[model samples]
Target: MPKRSNYWLGAGLVFGAAFGFALKGIFIKSAYEYGIDTISLLSLRFLFSVPFYIFILSRKRIQEESHPQVPTITWLKLFAVGFVGYYVSAYFNLLGLNYITASLERILLFVYPTFVLILRAILLKKRITHLQWLALGITYLGIVLAFLKNFDAHQQKNIGLGAFWVILSGFTYAFYLISSDGLIAKLGTTRFTSWVIISALFPTLIHCYIENRLDIFNFPIPVYIISMSMAVFSTVLPTFMLSEGIKHVGSGNASIIASIGPIFTIFLATAFLGENIWLEQIIGTVFVLIGVFLISWKGKK
Candidate 1:
C-alpha cells in the first residue's frame, strides 16, 4: 500500500478496534444484568479468549518462527503487564462500570493516551511538544466537561468511588502499553498477544474461583453466547487488529484514532440500549476529537 493508503488502513483498523471495544460495554452490562459479577465476567471473557490467542500463535509459529524470538524474560514481562494491565485494570473498570454509566467509564478510560504520553516522557525521556501539551490540556478539559454534563444528583451517590477505580484502570492500561511496546517489537504482535492472554489465564482462573461463578456454565444459552462473542469480538479480534495496526500507524496515531471510541459508543448505546445522548456528550466528543487531532497532527520536522 502507498503511504497514504497505509495510514487510512491503520486508521480504519484502529476505528474498528475501538468500536469493538465500545461494544464490550454492552455485552458486559448485559452479562452483569444476568447476575455475573465483575470478576466472574472478566474471568470468563479472558478464558474464552485464550483459545483464539492460541490459534493465532500457532499459525504464526508455523509461518514465522524464525522471524521473532521471544525470550523467557519477555514472557515474564508480558505476564506482569497482563496481570497489572489486563487483569487488574479490567477488573477495576468492570467494578466501576457496575456503579457508573458506561459513558462515564469510557471517558475515564480515554485518559489512557494522556497517561501513555506521560509514561513515555518519564520512562523514555521523550520531550513532548507545546502542541502536544496543549492538546493534553484540551483533552482533559473535555473529560471534565463530559463529567459535568453527565453528573446527576442521584448518581452522585457513589460516583466518587467509581471515578477512582476508573482512573486506576487508565493508569494500569498506560503502564501496560509502555511496558509491552518493547516486547511487541521483539515478539511480533501475534506472539506477544498470545503470551499476554496465556499469562492472564492464571489470574483470571483464580478470580473465577474466588467469585465462585463457575455456574456461568449453567447460565442461559444466550448469556453464554453473548459472553463468548464478547471474548471473540471485543477481546480477541480487536486486540489483533490493534496490535497490527499500531505496527503500521505508530502508537501516537493509534491512540488518537482510538479517541473516536466514545463517539461510536454513544451512538451504539443510543440505538440498542435506548440511552439518550445529552448535549454535553456531543460537545465532549468534539473536544476529544479536536484534542486528539491537535496532539497527533504535526509537520514532519
Candidate 2:
C-alpha cells in the first residue's frame, strides 16, 4: 500500500514537472514580445537558476565530504555531459523556437525518448525489440505528418530549418541522458543534477558574454519577471521534481507520465499564444504519445 501510494505521488510529481516544462514555450514567447533577444533571455534564465544550483551543490558537497573521494575523471565526465546536454541542446532548442510554433517545438522535443531508444540500439549494441520497431515506425510517421503540416502552414524554409534544429536538440539530449545514465545512478538524482547544472551555467555565461548584446539594465521589467518565473517554475522546479519522480516511480513510468507534455503545450500555445491546432497536429500528437507509451511500457516488462 505504501509503495502504491508512493507511485501515485511520484506520478503526480512527474505530471507537474511536465506541465511546468510545457509552460516554457509560452514564457519564451512572452519574453520575445518584449523585444528580448534569445541570448539575453537565455542568460537571464541561467543567471536566476545558478544561485539555486549553488545552494544545492553546497549541500551536496557537505553531505559527501565524509564519503570516499570522487575521482577527477568523474568531474570531467559531469562537465562534458553538462556542456552538451543542457547548454548546447538548450541553445539549439531556443533557436528552433524562434522560427517554429511552441506546439511544434514541444512535440519535436518530446521525441527524445525515441532517439534514446534508437541510439542505444546502434551505439550500445542493444537488441532492437519488435515492439520498439513498431514504436519507431509510429513515431517517425507521426513526425513526418506533423512536419508536412508545419511546412504547409508556415514559412516552408523556416519550418524546415527549425525542424532540423529541434531534431538535433532531441538527438543531443538523448545522447546526454543515455551517456549519463551510470553517473545518475551513482550520484543520486539531486546531487547529479546540481553538478550538471552548475557545470552548464558557466558555459552559458561565456556564450552570453561572447554575444555581448545583453544590456541587462535596459530590459523592461516584464522580461525580468518572466525570465525569473522561467528559472523557478520551468527550470529548477521541474528538474528536481522529475528527478524525485524517477526515484519513486522509476524512469520508465516517469517518462510515460511526461509524455503528456506535448499535448499540454499544444493547449497552452493555443490559449496563450493564439496558435491554431489542426487535425494533422492532433493525429500526429496521438501517434507520438502512443509510440512513447509503447517504448516506455515495454521497458518495464
Candidate 3:
C-alpha cells in the first residue's frame, strides 16, 4: 500500500474504533435500564471478551522454545494494573453514569488526555512545549464549559460526587494507558491484552460476589444480547481495530484521532438519547480538538 493510502486507512480504523467505544456507553445505559448492575455487567462483559482474546493469541504462528512464562512479579504488576485500571476505573465510571448524563460522562472522561500529558511529564521528567500547554488550557476550558452548560439546578446535589468519581476514573485510565504501553511493547498487544483481561477476572469476580448477582442464566434475552454486544462490538472488534490502526498510524496520530470520541458521543447522545447539545459543548469540543492536536502534532522549525 502507498503511504498516503495507509494513512487514510489507519484514520478510518481509528474513527471506527472511536465510534465503537462511544456506542458502548449507550449499551451500558440501556443495560442499566434492564436492571443490570455494574458488577454483573462487567463480569459478563469481560467473561465474553476473554475467549475472543484467547483465540487471537492462539493463532500466532510463533512457537516458543519453552512456553513463555511471565514472572511472578510481572504477573503481580499486570494484575494490579488490570484491577486498578480496568476493573476499578470501569466500576466508578458506571457508578457515575448512573447519576450523570452520558454526554457529561464522556466529557469528564475526555479529561484523561490532559491527565496523560501531565502524568507523563511528572513521571518521565519531560517538559511539555508551550503549544502543548496552550492546548491543555484550551481543552480544559472547553471541558469546564461543557460541564456548566450540562449542569441542572435540580441535580446540583450529586454533580460534585459524580464529577469526582468520573475524574478519578479518567486518572486511572491514564495510568493504564501509560503503564500498558511498556508491557505491550514487551509482550505484544494481543498477548498483553489477554493477560490483562485474565488478571481483571479476579477483581470482577469479587465485585460480582459483593453485588450477589452471579446467576447469568437468569438474565433476560435482551440483556444477554446487549452484554454479548458489549463484548464483541465494544471490546473485541474495537480493540483489534485500534491496535491495527495504532500499528499503522503510530500512537501519536491514533491519540489525536481518538480524541474526537467525546464530540462524537455528544452528538450521538443528542440524536439517540434526547440529550441536549449546548453551545458550550460545541466550544468545548473545539478546545479539546485543538488541545489534542497540539499535544500530538509534530513539526520542525
Best by lDDT: 2
> What pairs collide in candidate 1?
none
The C-alpha local distance difference test score for the whole of candidate 2 amounts to 0.86
RMSD of each: 2.6, 1.8, 2.6
Clashing pairs in 2: none
Error of 2 at 125 (Å): 0.7
lDDT of each: 0.78, 0.86, 0.79
RMSD of 2: 1.8
- Determine the C-alpha RMSD for candidate 3 after optimal superposition of all C-alphas: 2.6
lDDT of 2 by residue, 1-301 (tens): 2399899999999999999999998999889889887778878888899899889878777977476567888889999999989898988888888888899899888889888888988998988899899998998888887777776775434787888888999999998988798888777778788888778888888887788745665799999999999999999999999988888888777888899999999999999999888899889989988888898888777
Residue 268, candidate 1: how far off, in angstroms? Answer: 0.9
Task: Give me the displacement of residue 221 in model 1, in angstroms.
Answer: 2.8
Off by over 4 Å in 3: 61-67, 153-157, 298-301
Worst 10 residues of 2 by lDDT: 148-157
Residues 1-301 of candidate 3 have per-residue lDDT tens digits of 4398898898899989998888777778778778877788888988988888778777663554456766787777788888877798888888787777777788788778778889989998768878878888887887787777656435435876777888899999989988887777767887777778777877898778766847655777898899899899888888888988987788777887887788778888878777677787788777767766676673211
Candidate 2 stretches greater than 4 Å from native: 61-67, 155-157
Better of 2 and 3 by TM-score: 2
Best of the two (1, 2) by lDDT: 2
